[model samples]
Target chain A: MARVVGSRLGVGLALSVVAVVIVALLSSSTRLAVALGLGVAVLGVGATLVSLPAVRRDHPVVTRALISVVVVDLAVVLTFRVSATSNSNVAIGAAMAIVLLGLSFLTGSSGQISLGNGAFMGVGAFTVGIWADHHATTPLVVVLVLATVAGALVGLVLGLPATRLRGPYLAGMTLAFAVAFGAILNVFSSWTGGDSGLQLPSAVVAPHWLASYFGPGASTLTTSSAWLADISIVVTGVALFLMANLFASRTGRAMRLVRDNDVAAELVGVSLPRARVVAFTVSAAYAALGGALWTLVNNAVSPSTYGFVLSITILSLVVIGGIGTIPGAIIGGIIYAFSAGAISWLTAHLGLNPQGNVASQLDGIIFGGLLVLTIVFAPMGIAGLVRHGWRRWRRG
Target chain B: MDSFLTSRNVSDLLGGVTSGVIYALVALSLVLIWRSTRMLNFAQGAMAVFATYIGFAILAPSTNYWVSMAVAILAGLVLGGVTERVLVRPLYGKPEINPIVAMVGLLLVLESIAAAIWSTSSRALATPFSIVDWQLNHKPVALSPFALYEIITSLVVMAIVAGLFQYTKLGLQLRAAALAPEVSRLLGVRVGRMLTVGWMLSTAVGAVTAVLVASNFFTGLTPSGMDGVFAFGFIAAAIGGLDSPVGAMVSGLALGVVFQFVGDYVNSNAIILVALAMLIVSLMVRPNGIFTRSAQRRV
Candidate 1:
C-alpha cells in the first residue's frame, strides 16, 4: 500500500511537469510544422527514459503508474500538434477530456449514475458568459471560481433528491433536469441571450510577459488557447492526484462500500446520504470548471451546446474509458477525440456532403457501435484490456 | 369562474382525454416491460419510432394502413426478441445500471439508423379516419373521427392485455418468471423464453401506441416523434407504480388531463417542469408509488 501510494504521487508530479512543459513548447512556436516533428521525438525519448526505472524495478504498481503518465503525456503532445497543424477545435477536445476525467472521479467513487452533469456544465459556462458580459475587467480565475460555486450550489439542490432515488428513478429525474434546464434557458432568453447564445469578450493578455517566457512569435489567440489547455491539464492532474489519495483514504473506502451495498454501509455507521451528496457536489464542481475552461477556449456559450447529446457523450466517455478508474477515463477521452476526427476525415475523404444524412449519422453509428461493443465484450473497458494484456506479456 | 369553464376549456379537457389514451398505451407498454424484466427500456421510444417508420414504408407502397400496422407489430416482436437474446441476456443479473446504459446506446443507434434511412424530415402518415371535428349543438367539438378511433382502439387493446394477464396460462408463467426466475425454472417453466415473450409483447404494445399516436395526434412522423410521449409515459408509470398496469393507465390519463390544463392555463414550457415536480413530490410521499402495497420494499 505504501509503495502504491508513493508511485501514485511520483506519477502525479511527473504528469504535472510534463503538462507545463508541453504548454510552454506549444504556445511558443508559430512554426508548428517544425515543432510537430520535434515534439514527437522529444516525447518518445522522454517516455523511454521514464519507463527505464520501472522496467528495472519490475514493480507492477510502479510500472502501471509510469505507463499511464507516459500515455497521457504522449496524448497531450500529439493532440496539441494535430490541432496546431490542422486548425481543428482542439480546445473542445481538451475541455471534454477534463470533464471526462472529472466524471470518472465522481462515478468511480460513488456507484451512482448522473445523467445531468451536462446541465451543471451549462451552469458553469453561462456563469462565465454572464459574468464576462457584465464584468469584463475581472480575471478569468475569479470567474471560474465563481462559476464552480454556482455549479456546486445547483448540484447540492439536485443531489438532495438524488439521495432518495436509486437506479432508473435517479436516472429519470436527472434526465428531467437536463430537459428542464434547456427549457429554462429558453424562457430566460433575455438573460441567457436566448437561443442565439452569448459571445465572450476578447481575452485580456499581457503579451510582453508571455513573449519573454515563450519566445517572441506567439499570437494572442494561440497563447490564449494554449493557456487554457495548460490550465486544463494542470487541473486534471491535480484532480486525479486528489482522487487517488481520496480513494486510498477511509472516506473513499466507505463511499465504495456504500456504492456496493448501501444497506451494508448503513449498518456499518456510514452516512449514505451525506456521502452521495458530497460526491455529486464535487463532481458538479469539476464539470463546472471544465465548462468555464470551455467558455474561455471557445469564447462563446450557447444553450444548445450543453444538451442531452453532450450528457450522453460524457457518460459514454466514462463507461468506455473504464468506470472507477482514472487511466480508463483518460484513454476514453483520447479515443473520443480521435474517433470524432476519424468520422470527419472519413466523410471528407469519401466526398460525402456534410449536410447529407449519412455524414450526419456517422458519429452516432461509430460511437454507438463502439459503446455497445465495449460494454458487451469489455465490461471492464480499455483499462481492463490493457491490464490483461500486461499480465499476459509478463507471463510470456 | 364562468370564463374559466368556457367552451374552450371544455374542448381542452376533451382534447386532453384523447391524448391521454395515447399516453396510457405507452405507459402500459413500459409497465409491461418493467414488470417482466426489471429493466427500464430507455430505448422504448426509439424502438417504437423505428417500427412506425417501417409501417410508413409499407404504407407508402401499398396504401393499406391495416397491413402496415400488422407488419409493424410483427416487426416489433422480432426486434424485441432479438434484442433480449443478443444484447440483454448477457447482462442479466448484473448491476442494474448496466442494462440502462446499454439501452441508452441502443436508443442512439436505433434513432441514428432511422434518421439515416428516412432522413430527419417529418412526413404525414395516412389515417383511415377523418381529421375533421364533429359538431355538438352547431359548435365544433374537440373529438374528431380519428380521435374516436384512437380512443376505441386503445381501449380494446387495453382490455385484451388485461385479459391476457388476468385469465391466461401464459400470463401466469410470465408472472412467475418475472417474480422468481429460479423458482419458475424449477417448476418446469422456460423462464428465459417467457422473458423473451414478455419483451415481444411489450414492444408490440409500444408499436401499437406509436402507430395510433402518429396517425392522428402527432401527424408528423419523424425519428424522434415519440420522445415526448415516452417522457409522459414514464411519468405516468412512475405515478401509477412501476409494477402496476392499472396504475399506469390511471396515472397516464391523470397526467394527460393535468398537462392539458397546465398547457391551456399555464405556460406550455412548464409542462415538463410540472411533470417533474409531480414526480418528485410523489416519490417523496410514496417512494414505491401510490398504488403499490406497503409491504413491498424497493432497493
Candidate 2:
C-alpha cells in the first residue's frame, strides 16, 4: 500500500512537470498560461500541505516554512479576491509583485544593487507595444520572448562594464542607464512620443472558458481583471520557479560566494567580475520579462511608468521583503501591492481629500519608514526576522 | 519662439545661465551633503521647495519682498537644522543606501506636506529685483536684478565658501571627519555635530537659491521647480568631482555657460538631455569628475 501511494505521488508530480512544459511551449495567450499557473500553484500548495505530516517528523523547519508560505498565499489570494472583483487585475498585481520579488531575491542574494530595472522595463514595454500595435504580426508568446531577449541583451552589455563598479558607483551607473534610456526614447519623439509618451494597446485577456473555470464565483470580477490575474500568476510562478532553480544550482552558489567575499571567491576559482555580470544578466532578464508582462497588462506602455520612482519603489520592496530571500521578496511584493491598492481604493471610495490621499505620498512614507526602521531594528529584513521567530518557537 | 530667440539670442543665453546659476547653488548644496556624508540627499530639492514656500508665506503677510526673503532664509536655516537632527541623525553610521532610501521617504513626506498645506494653486511670486535694460558694446543688454544677484551672490558665496573651507579650523575638522571618520573620532572631534552643522549650512544655502530662483521664475515653486536644479546640479557636482569644493564652483559656472549655449542653439529641453549626456560621458571618461581624485577608484 505504501509503495503504491509513493508511486502515485511521483506520477502526480511528473504529470505536473509535463503539463508545465506543455503550457510553456504551446501557449500564445498570457492569460491561459496565467490560469494554468494558478491551477499549478494551487496544486503545489495542496500537495505540500499533504506532505507536511510526513516531513514534519523529520524536517520540521522545512515543513513549517512550506506551511507558512501556503498560509501567506492564502491570505494574499483572499485579499486580492476581496479588493479586485476581476481575476485579471489581481493576477496582474500578483504577477508584478512576484516578478519584483523574484528579481529582488536574485539581486539581494547575489549582492548586486541595480537600478537598471527601470531601463529594462522601458525597453520591454516599448518593444512589445510597438510589435503588437504596428506589425500586429508577432504572436503574443513570440513578442514576450523577444522582449525578454532584447532586455537580456541590453542588460548584458550594461552589466559587462557595470560589474566592474561596486556599491555606490554601480548604482550610479545603472541610474544613468535608466535616465539615458528615457532621454533616448524622448529624443526619438516620433516613435516614443518624446515628452508625450506613446500609447500602449489594450491589454489582452484570458479566453472566456478559462476565465469562467477559475473565476467560478468571480461574478464581481471583470474580464480585464480576470486576464490580469491569469497573466500575473503564470509569469510570477514561472519566474519564481526559475529563480529558485538557479539558487539551487552551482552558478547560484558561486554567485553567493562572490557576493560574500570576492577575494575569497577568486581564490576558489570564481571570477568576481563574471559572477557579477551573470547576476546582473539574470536580473536584467527578469526585469525585462516582467516589463513585457506589465505592458501587456496595461496595453499601453509609457516612459513614466518605469522611472526613478519605480526603480526606487522596487528597491524598497526588496529591502522590505528581506533583501535576499525568496519568501521575503514574495511577501514584500504582496505587502506593497496591498498597501498601494488599499490606499488607492480608499482615496477613491471614501472620497478623501487630496491631502489625505495616502496613495500620492504613501510610498515615500512607507518606504522611508521601512528603510530607516529596517536599518535600525530589522537589518536582517522580514525573512530574517521570520527565521529568527521560527528558531525561537522551536527552542521554546 | 524662433523669432523671439533670434531677436534676443544673447539675452536668452544670459537668461538661461541666470537660471542655471540657481541650479548650481542647489548643486553646491548637494555637494556639501555628499562630502560630509557620502550620500546624495535626494530630498535636497524638495527641502528647497518647502523652504521657498515658507518664505513665500512669510512674504505674503508682508509687502516688502526683501524682508520676506530674509525671513525665508531664516526659515531655511531652521528647517535644514531640524531635518538633519530628526531624519539624518539616525542614519549617520548606517549603510550608504539607508540614507538614500530615507531621503526618498523624506522627499515624499515633504512634497505631500507641501501639497496638503499649500493646495495646488500656482502662486506667482513677485521678483524682488526688476529687469533693467542696459546698452553694452552697441547692443541692448537686458539685465534683471535677480540675474545680477544670482551672478554676484553665487560668485561671492563661492569665494567666501572657498576661503572658509581652505582657511578655517571648522573646515579643517570637517574635511578630516569626512576623510577619516575613525581617526577623527579618536581625535575627540565632534564628528556627528559637525555633520549636523554641515546639513544646516548646506540647507541654508539651498534656501537662498530657492528664493532667488523662485523670484526670478515668477511662480510659486512647485514640488518640481527644483527638479531641473537637482539634475543639473548633479552634472555640475560630477564634473567638478564629488570631493572638490573649488571644482564645484568652476563646474557650476561651466555647466551654466554650457546650458546657455545649448539653450541658444538646441531645443531648450535639449539642455536637460545634454546634462544627462554629460553624466554618461563623465562616468565613462572621468568618473572621479574633472577634478581627478587620484586616490579613489574610477569605476
Candidate 3:
C-alpha cells in the first residue's frame, strides 16, 4: 500500500513538471498566458486528486483520471484558443467530430467497417446543397433536418444488403457502391454540379441568444459558425454518449455477442440478421448525419472531393483512431486535419516545393510511409498507445 | 441493322474488334494476378502506365515505336517481378483487407513515383502503323495498321499463354502452385519462384496492353494517361469472368462493341454510365465473374 502511494505521487509530480514546461512554452501574451497557466494548474490539481484513489489500489480510477485530464485539456483548447468566431476550420473540425462519433458508434459498437462513408457524406452534402439551392427562403434548420433524414434513409437502404456480408466482403461491396456513386454523380452532372461541384448557402444563425453574449463592443463573429459548431458538437457528443451508454446496455451487448460468435448468438435466441440490420441502419444514419453536418459547414459540395481517396482517408481515420473508441476517432480526426497542413508547412519552411521534382514527390512518399508504418507498428493505432500508457502508469 | 448480323458484324466490327483485342490483352493480365493470388490487382493499369512511360523515355530520341513497346514490356516484366518479391510477398496469407489496403497504397505510391520519375508533361506517342483503306461490302472502310497489329498480336499472345499453361512443365508447376501452394510445395514446387514468374508474365502482358492501346488512342502520358483503357479493361474483365482467359477476350470485345456503337448511337457521354451499370449488373448476377466459380469465404 505504501509503495502504490509512493508511485502515484511520483507520477503526479512528473505530470506536474511536464505541465510546467508546457506552460513555460505558451507563456507569451498576457491574456493567453494567464488562461493557459490557470488551466494547467487546475488540471494538475485535478490529476493529483484523481490519483489518490489509484494510490490506494483502485486501478480503474487511473483511466478515469487520464480521460478526465484529456477532456479538460480539450475543453480548455476548444473554449479558449479555438474560437468558433469566424473560424471555418474549427467549424469543420467540430462537424468532423460529430461524424467521427457517429462512425465510432456504428463501427465500434456494431463490428462493421464501412468503405462507403465518403459516398454517404456526399449524399448528405448534396441533399442539403440542393435544398439550400432550390429553397433559398427555407429555414436553415429545416434544410439540415431534411438532408439528415434523406441521408439516413439512403444509408439504411445501402446497409440492407450489408446485413448478410461481413468483413472484407462487406467492405468490397461498399467500395463498389462508392465507386459507382462517384461515377453516377459525375454522369448526372446537372444535379450534382458534375465535376465542378454544387454551391450551398452559408448556414444562417437564426439569431440565437448566444450571439447576443459577445456584447456591443466585442469583435463580432458570424452567428452561423458559432451556432453550427456548438450544435454539431453538442448533438454529436450527446449521440455518441448515448451510443456508449447503449454499448454498456443490453442492445450493445447483443451486437457484441453477434460480432464475437454468430453461432453462440443464434443459440441465445437473438435474431442474428435483425441485429446486423439494426447495426447497419444505425451506422448509415450516423454517416448521413456526419455528411449533413459537413455540408452545413462547407456550404458547398464537389463530386471529386468525395471520391475513393476521401473514402480511403475516412477509413484510415477510423483505423488510426483505434477501431472501437470514440475519443480515438476525435484524436484520429485531429491528426488527419493537422497532418496535411503540417506537411505543407514543413515543405514550405524548408523551401522544398521550389526545390524541383524531389520536393514535389515528397508528399506521396510521406503518405505511403505513414500508411506502412502505422499498419506495421501500431495496428491498434493511437488509441491503443494511449491505453497502453495509461495501463503502465497505473501499474507503476 | 444489317451490320448487326454476326458475319456482317465481323466486317463492320473492325473498330470493336481492335479495341476488344486490346482490352482482352489487358484483361489477361488481370486474370493472371487474380488466378494466382486471388486478389484483384487494381494497380495493374497504373503499373502498365509506368512501364509505357519508361518505354517512352527510352524511345524519346527516335521514332521506333516497336522498340518502345518491347522495352516497356520488358520494364513491366522487371517491375512486376520486383513488386511481388518486395511488397506483395509479405502480404500473402494475410487477411484480404490487408492486401487491398496495401494495393491501394501501392497504386498511390506508383502514381507519385511515376510523376516524380517522369515529368508530368503529356507526350504524344507515334504508332508504327500508318492509316490504310480496306474494302468491306463495297464501302471504303478505313483500318489503321496499328489496330490490325493489335488484333494479330492479341491472338498470338492468347495462343502462347494457352499453350504454355496447358503443355509446358513450367505451366503445370505454376498451375499447381496457384491452385494449392501447400500441395505444390510438398510436391517440390518452388511456389515463391512460380509466383515471381507469374508476376513477371502478368506485368509483361499489362505492358503490351498499355503500349498497344496508348499508342492507338491515348498517345499522351499523365498520371491518368492510361485511365480510360484501364476503365474499359476492368469492365471487360468484369463482364467476362475474372478467371477465364477466353472470357476476358470475349468480354473485352463485347465491351468495346458496346462502347463504340452505344456511344455512336446514344449519348457519347453515357458510355461510362452504361459501363458502370453493366458492371453493377454483372456483379449482382455473377459476382464470381462470367467465367470463374463463385468466391467462398474462409470464415
Candidate 4:
C-alpha cells in the first residue's frame, strides 16, 4: 500500500487550523490556558495508550493526530507560563530554531550553502525595528507578515542570480552578502540608527485582555516576554509544520532529486533553477521570520548582532546538531541558547577567570571544535548519529 | 572631476601602492593553499591570526621583531601541517562540501584559540620602524618606513613564492602531487608528505603576510584582525585566478589601489559594498579570472 503522506499533512493542517481558531476566538483567558494544558495532558495519555505496538500497527492515524494536537497544545501552553527568564530563552531558541530549520532545509535538502543566513535575519530584524519605530500602531501579525514579505523579496532578487551561479561563485556572493551587511546598516544609518542600531518603540505586549486575564497585577515586563515567547513558539510550530509538509510533498522529492543530480531532476521534468530558487526564497522567508521574532524578543536590533559571525554560528549549529532533522534543529537551538554559560562554567572550573578572555573565547572554541569534529567524524550530526544507533539497535 | 586628482590624490595613489602590496600578499597566500590542496582554505585568516598571536606572545616580552616573526612563521608551518594531516586528510575524495565544512570548522577553532590566549582586545605589534608618514617637499606622503617595510616584506615574500612555484624542483613535486597524485605517487613523489609540506610553506608565507599587514596598524593583533584582510584577499584571489600565484599578486595589488581610490573618492565604509559589486560583476563576466587563462574548474 502506498504511504499516503498527504493524509498526515491533511490531518496536520486541519488540526493546526482548529487550534489557531480556538486561540483566536478565546484570544486571552486563564480558563483557555488551563484547558489547553489539561487537553494536551489527556491527549498525551491517550497517545501513549494508542502507541502500544499492536495499536500503533492497526491505527497509525492516531499517532499523526496526537502529534499535531501535542505540538499546537504545547505551543499555546508555553506562552501562558510566567517564567520571564525561561520565556526569554524560549524566544531565543525558537528564533534560532526557525533560522536553523531554513538553513538545514536549504543546505541539507537541496545542497545550497548560504553564508548569508544571518544577513537575511538582519533584514527582517531591522525591518521590524524600523517598522515598529515608524508605524507604532501596526499589529504584530501585520508587522511580521511585512517582514516575511521583505525577506522573500530579497531572497527572490538574490535567488534569481543564484540560479545562474554554481558552487564557488554562489559561496562568494553569499560571503559578500554577509560581509557587506555592516556596510548596508551603515549606509542607511538614518533609518538604521547607524552604529547604535534601532530599537522597537516598546516591548511586544500581549493584548490588554490577555495580559489582564493572565496577570492581573503581574509585571508588564515579564508578561510581555511571555507574550513574545508565545508568538515565537506559535510561529515556529507553524514553520515546522510547513517544513514537514514540504519534506513530504512532491516538491520535496524534486528538491532531493535536484540535489542528488540536477540532470536527473531535469530528466524527470523538474526545473532546476525554479526548484533552487524556491528553496532559497522559502529559506530566506523562514530566516526573516526568525529575525523578526528575535527583534520582538530583544526589543532591539543591531548590525553587530546579525553579522558574519552569527552567520557562521548558525551554520555550525545546524551542522553539529544534525543538518536534515527537525530534532537536530531543536538541538542546535538548545545549544546556542545554553552553550555560553556551560562553556564559561567549565572554563572557570579549569581555573580560568570568569571575567577573562578564555572564558569568553571558550564558546567559540567549543562551537568550532564541535563543528570540525562533527564534519570529520560524525558528518550525520548528533541527531543523525542517534537515529543510526536506534536503527541498528532495533535491527539487532 | 578637478577635485579628484589633486596633489593629495597623487599622494593617495602613492599610498595605494604601498597598501596594495598587503592585499597582494594576502592573495599570494591564498593562491599557495589553493594550488597545493586544490581546496580553498577557509581557515587561512584564522591561521594567520593564530600565528600572529604566537608572535605577539614572544614580542611582548622580548620586544624583538625579527625573532618573533621567525617564531610566527615556524608556528604557522606546524599549525598548517597538523591541520592538513589531522583535519583535512580524511576529507580526500569525499564530497566537495565536506572539505569546506572541515576548513570552516578549523577556522573557528583557530580563531577561538587565539581569542582565548590573547583575548579579543587589539594588541600592539611593536614594529622597529616608525609608522609616521614620510613627507616630501613639505607635503605628507603615505610611505612611512613601516609602510615601506610592509611593502618590501610582502612583495619579497610574494616574489619568493611565485619564483619557487615557477623555477624549483620542490615546486614541481608539489604541483605534480596536487594535479596528479596517483601519477606522482608512482613517480616516487611521497604525495601525502608533499601536501603537508605545501600547506606548511603556504601558511608560513601566510604568517609573514599577516605580520606585515598587522604591523601596518599600531594596535592590530586580535583574533579577528585578519578577517577584513582575508575577505579582500579572497576577492583578490578570485579576480587573479584561484589557481595562479602571480595572478593573485597582480590583481591583489591592483584591487588594493582600486579600493583606496574608491575609499578616497567614495564612502570609505561602503567600500566593501563596492567589493561585493565588483565580485558579482567579475564572476558574471570573467568567472575564470580577469587576468589568468582559462583552466578546468572543479566548481
Which candidate ranks first by DockQ, i.e. highest? 4
Tell me the native contact fraction for each prediction. Answer: 0.39, 0.15, 0.20, 0.57
| Candidate 3: residue A49 Cα off by (Å) | 11
DockQ rank order? 4, 1, 2, 3
Model 3 has a DockQ score of 0.26
Inter-residue clash pairs, candidate 1: none
Q: Which of the numbered candidates is closest to the native, going by highest TM-score?
A: 4
Q: Rank the candidates by lDDT, best first.
A: 4, 1, 3, 2
iRMSD, all candidates: 1.7, 3.8, 3.7, 2.1
TM-score of every prediction relative to native: 0.88, 0.81, 0.79, 0.89
The window of 10 residues in a row where model 1 chain B has the poorest summed lDDT is: B1-10
lDDT of 1 by residue, A114-175 (tens): 77778889989999999999998886568878998998998887777666666787776676
Q: Which regions of candidate 1 fall more than 4 Å away from where they truly are?
A: A1-88, A203-216, A220-224, A348-351, B1-6, B58-62, B137-139, B295-299
Please state the CAPRI-style docking class of candidate 4.
medium
Q: Worst ten-residue run, lDDT, model 2 chain B? A: B1-10
* Predictions' DockQ, in order: 0.52, 0.26, 0.26, 0.58
Which of the predicted structures, 3 or 4, would earn the higher lDDT when compared with the native? 4
Native-referenced Cα lDDT, model 3: 0.68
Output per-candidate TM-scores for chain A, rounded to 2 decimals.
0.81, 0.77, 0.76, 0.84
Give one digit per residue, the lDDT tens place, for model 1 in B176-216.
99889889999998999999998899888889888887778
**The 10-residue segment with the lowest total lDDT in model 4 chain B:** B1-10
lDDT of 2: 0.67
User: For residues B40-115, could you state the per-residue lDDT of candidate 3 as single tens digits?
Assistant: 6767877888898888875664858778878898999999999899878887876455565565556656767877
Best candidate (score: lDDT):
4
Model 4, residue pairs in steric clash: none
